[model samples]
Target: MNLSPKLLEVFTTALAVPADQITADLDYQGIPEWDSMSHMILIAELESSYAITIETDDLLEMTSVTNVVDRLKKYGIEA
Candidate 1:
């Protein structure tokens, strides 16, 4: 499971955005598509995809693609 592609897929599908538009620099709430509802959906997608539970602090810290990768790393996932 390559993390990059999986991340893109999750964000794209969850946010209803184009795959090419998602980047490491893309931040949560940085775009209209990444609203509160989409954030929860995105979290769900990520949790299901990685098969891990994210703590509240970590969930709040997941602001960008880079942040997500870093957080997942702590859970034994590498991008």
Candidate 2:
């Protein structure tokens, strides 16, 4: 499946990157904009958008776009 539009929006907004730059290969620290602070912002945006609380373990595992999609899947959010 392709990356969800909502997921892409969250990434672009939180990381301040263009949508074209947010590929499946994108990972934490892969781009300068996706730093520590932005990660928290990403998490918050995700929580609010999906209406689910991401646990610490899941948070630690969300290192890449693919991984984030996987984590969201566990929450029943087909991202």
Candidate 3:
């Protein structure tokens, strides 16, 4: 899956996990840095990287690694 490199960096850093560990099935709860603050940072990071605003519905639905790609795709981002 070809994803945005900046998005990958944001997720990996925000989750405190290696980039390779990030995948479609990986849930946010599985990472330590996926807490409240991190979630906020992740949201901001995604916005900055994609140059697009994420909707509240998409924000609430972002539970797993795949969900990020999914939500962004809905906004016209290629997966």
Candidate 4:
């Protein structure tokens, strides 16, 4: 699935990866750039970009791009 430009920017900026690499299967720690350190950055970026406070439980569920998208759904977000 293609990501919205805003969502694409979040992944790219937080992970320091190319936009093309931000696929649904992009798993946490599955890539060198998306390691533990970057995961926290990614979470912070998500919160900032969406203006939503993610819960601790939801954080563990954010294992992949698809998972992040799903998690956002809980907040009534379209990304």
**CA lDDT, every prediction?**
0.86, 0.92, 0.80, 0.92
Q: Give the per-residue lDDT of model 4 (tens digit) for 3-74.
A: 889999999999999998898898988999998899999999999988899999999999999999999899
Compare the candidates by TM-score and give the number of the best one.
4
lDDT of 3 at 15: 77
Clashing residue pairs, backbone N/CA/C < 3 A, model 3: none
Q: State every prediction's TM-score relative to the real structure.
A: 0.90, 0.95, 0.83, 0.96
Give the Å shift of residue 8 in candidate 1: 1.5
Q: Which lDDT value does model 3 have at 38?
A: 84
What's the CA RMSD of model 2 in angstroms? Answer: 1.1
Best by lDDT: 4
Tens-digit lDDT track of model 1 for 1-79 = 2347777788788999998778778888899998999999999998999899999999999988789889988899887
Error of 2 at 65 (Å): 0.4
Model 3: residue 16 alpha-carbon error in angstroms: 2.7
Model 2, span 1-79: residue lDDT tens: 3778898899889999999998888899999998999999999999999889999999999998889998998999986
What does the lDDT read for residue 54 in candidate 2?
97
Relative to the unseen true structure, what is the C-alpha lDDT of residue 71 in candidate 2, on a scale of 0 to 100?
92
Ranking of candidates on TM-score, top first: 4, 2, 1, 3
10 residues in a row with least lDDT, candidate 1: 1-10
